[model samples]
Target chain A: MNGYAGKILRINLSDHTYKTEELDKDKALKYIGGRGLGSRIMAEEVPPTVDAFDPENKVIIATGPLTGTPTPAGGRYMVVTKSPLTGTIASSNSGGFWGSELKFAGYDLLILEGKSPKPVNIFIEDDKITFKDAAHVWGKIVSETTSILAEEAPDKAKILCIGPGGENLSKISAVMNDINRAAGRSGVGAVVGSKNLKAIVVKGSSKPTIADSEKLKEVVKESRGKLKDNGVTGQGLPTYGTAVLVNIINEGGVFPTNNFQTTYFDKAENISGEHLAENFLIKRESCFACPIACGRYTKADEVEGGGPEYETIWAFGAACGVDDMKSVIKANFWCNEMGLDTISAGVTIAAAMELYQRGKITDADIDDGLSLKWGAGESLVEWVKKMGRRDGLIGDKMAEGSYRMATHFGMPEVAMAVKKQELPAYDPRGIRGQGLQYATSNRGGCHVRGYLISPEILGLPQKLDRFAIDGKAEWVKIFQDLTAFIDSAGLCLFTSFAIDGEGYANLTNAVLGTDFTQEDILEAGDRIWNLERDYNLKAGIDPSQDTLPKRLLKDPIPDGPSKGNVTRLEEMLPKYYEIRGWSEKGIPKAETLEKLGV
Target chain B: MKIKVRLFATLRENRGKELELSLQDKATPEDVIQELEIAKSDVAILLVNGRDGDFSQELRESDVVSIFPPVGGG
Candidate 1:
């Protein structure tokens, strides 16, 4: 109770009824918070056999103990539910002021259940909660929805809303906040939309009380100073944002280009962070108390929005073969406005382009006669809007995401996805461990949950050859579990680049008043990972689903520094299973579950 | 041989601004740092022709070298 708001607000959309539940200290201790808490609740409450879009499924928005506290990068939250895309437990953490505001509203988590008969939005102010009719705002874009809510609620409110994409139940839809920030993966927005829930607006006046306020202030001050002193956080990120990785990853021969067919891109420099900093960036932004301020507020021509970060740049630029910076930024803005996951949207479009090029599909197949061409930014933006509105054949096919889209085209392998979700920026063939991570990730092909690229590419902690398969399994397991802890702590994983596990442990201890050691934190992270895996397992996922795409496993990188390298996933996966205390088939062993108390 | 040496992020700030360093043939990355009067500890990543290189990595003529200070990362 010292760190938590000590309440969970449950809204049953079925009957338009709402109730508040006292926070359980036992659950908090076991699950910690954020993705951890959300996963635990979903596992215990929702049946594994339930369809993700069914009325029985629950969507949980959760904040950690550190969130809303005077801690650096504490303005974070997680959206967890069974994914309509992957049919697995989907937990996507996002950064914005919403999580902190929710914490300020005296609630640790918001759990929405059952399908509503009519569109509605939930508003929470301190201890007061209201369900408002969302008929007028139901079909609005994310930006418009937020604007309307802000006008109605004034400066005190923060809204997390979806756009037409979510209303149509597009599998790649996202929940957007602060206009551009998103809980952007795994179709959590679609699940919310399926329930006829439009958004959750929160305004809180209560300030959190800590047991050792002085100690927490000191720790926060020190942490902020450390972040400011660090080069990546203090300078690189603030100046260029994550788009800086375009050149770096391209140089490493791991930047996904043309839908993972190649590693390097000749036009990478055109979309590099330097290009963004030089052309578009007008200012830098930060989430509550964060010093890094990697958020880019930029303008280009007539378009103005949060400029595409590294992932979005790669997704729209290199992955889709469009190198025009303005076009990529435009695409990013469109996706944000439409409330689509840029990664999935870009990858799905990339797949469509490939199919078009291979004569698998044609412009005639599209309702608007839109051409699917690589580097065709205009058409790409048009398709993005179409997908959001479900306007045409291409839009309808793409709304289902790459896997289903590819299947419809009679070539499922062209999807470049693992377990239905498309891969992010990294080309797994060039980074062997990342392939394993993507293949085995509980959320289906997500990189953030456990970014091994820190060690494999950036050489944080220690340097490992990006092209090597040696000892990668242990590295992946270590990073995966530790990253799970960071995600649950409501802290950005970016801080781990310079800050060690001890730094995070210290912050957690200061915020929660829990004596958490580095080992204890790692164990907690492992427990969260196992819990997610268990959820996926019960959801019918097995070892077969935990495998990389054939292209990454069989086809080698055609050129560049990593030429001839294919992901040696087989070499690392068995060892990875052993390290995770799982069986040979990647199932969490009973002993492992017992050890983690899951 | 003259090569374009660009300092970025923290390194640029630490070194006052972006710098263009001229070096002799077969000069190592360390020599460029010395020429720029940058502390060895200030350089976190050294890129020669857009690939990771160490201080001992010899620079070639016309190499577009980029040196960055340690930045907090993900």
Candidate 2:
């Protein structure tokens, strides 16, 4: 238990009951931690046939060994559950002070089960965990509820909670920590609300017990130096945050303008990182133990909030066909305060905009006088407010998310999604690798799952020919497996840009008192990925679901660098199956599963 | 002949947004980058006239050249 809490906190909100279970060391070693541990626990305990919102379904909050340590960008945590949006297994990660805080509170994972008879909040101070009535703060937005909890709980306690978005049961709802950082994907927040739990606050003093403390300190220092020396992780990110990706991606003609209809956003620079840094950025923020502090604090006119990240900027900018910086900034702030997932909400609005432009929807069809025209700043800002409280005529449809909304309008092709989850910022027509990544990601259309853009665009590790689809399957698999390891290790994925697998193995070996080499650690990553795939299979999701949207496959980007290009998923699919040791249909083979010991 | 050379990310930090550079008719992207004093190692994606072009690809008159560094995350 040197590097872990070695215990799991189980909470049953049905009757306000709770218990602590000892975690097996063998299981921990095999699964590693964070998402791997969460998925393993979910696979073992939860029945595949149950509904995502069913009381029997559980939400697992997990942290890894490096959390609460001096490792660079190591302060991270993950939320694993059956996704309300995609009905797939969901593992969303977040960085802030929360994960380390949880580890210090003496728990590795918190498993929530059943539903509360009434609204409540979970409070943890050392070993004293109790339920506090949250009926009064229940309906307030995330920030208000957070401040209220801070006032009621210990002065130094950290709070992770939801807002009206979750309270109203929006599929795009997110769990907000430290006021803004989010485990913001796959409707995990809705699951938390279904349990009638509002927030969890923690205050503790226990540090992770490391096996080689002195060595860990040295490795941590060395890792920090690597981060400082890297450009993307060090200078670019800290200066412009993730928004720096806007102009560069736009120049590549992969910015996903107007809901993937085109691959270029003409006014990209208007809402780019350079613009934010020059006009609105008031401060730069970082998570616990992060050296590449990429979090930006912004103020525009009278509004101030955590700055819109690259994905959010693209979602409200090119995805919606808008490039007004102030409007996007306001939407970002409003989304955080409302506990709404910016990607889902902004993409959903963009989907509606496409419908309106194509004559599929009319003003009469829209409730109120709200216009959803492209490049209309007012519409984007208003939609975020409407979505938070599920207001007006668009409320129920918006709450259903983009895929269902597109289906209602008979334009599912324009949904710009895979597996019912809207795609991220990158337009796959230009960056072929990420298109494959979106199609194959277990958590649906997500970027972080397997960031193939690093090679195709960013050229990290090594650059690849973005136009070629020949070896992209192999590259995507490697990145996915590698990313899985980083997620489970409780370290930031950005670290990989600086250190190799051996560097990570050194840190793990020092912390966990294990002599495993880099290959051993990578094998665990492979195991974790296969376990997740296996869980999805058992949950009745077929491998045939591994595909891009029809628009990505059939329609060509009309102009720009990747003009007349469609995602070559057909060529990569069989290759990816071969690389993954899966059957041609993309299902994991029996031998592969057993090989992973899943 | 003149070519529009666009710099991005860190390249923009060293050089200005864009400069119309005078070059020989057979000038390649490499020649343009060298004229701008940009290190080849720093270049991730080089586009000529809005198409994927390598450093060795030949440039044309009035053709727009955009050079970018490797930028990842999300």
Name the best candidate (by DockQ): 2
Query: Which stretches of candidate 2 lie above 4 Å from their native place?
Result: B13-15, B39-45
lDDT of 2 by residue, A391-429 (tens): 876766777689888888888777877888988998887
lDDT of 1 by residue, A354-435 (tens): 9988888976786665677888776777888988888877898899999999999899999888889988998888778888
Comparing chain B with the reference, what is the TM-score for each candidate?
A: 0.81, 0.91
Residue A282 C-alpha lDDT in model 2: 92
Candidate 1, position A223, lDDT: 82
RMSD of 2: 1.5
Clashing pairs in 1: A231-B70, A231-B71, A232-B71, A232-B72, A233-B72, A494-B74
Interface DockQ of each model? 0.32, 0.54
Give me the candidate number with maximum TM-score: 2
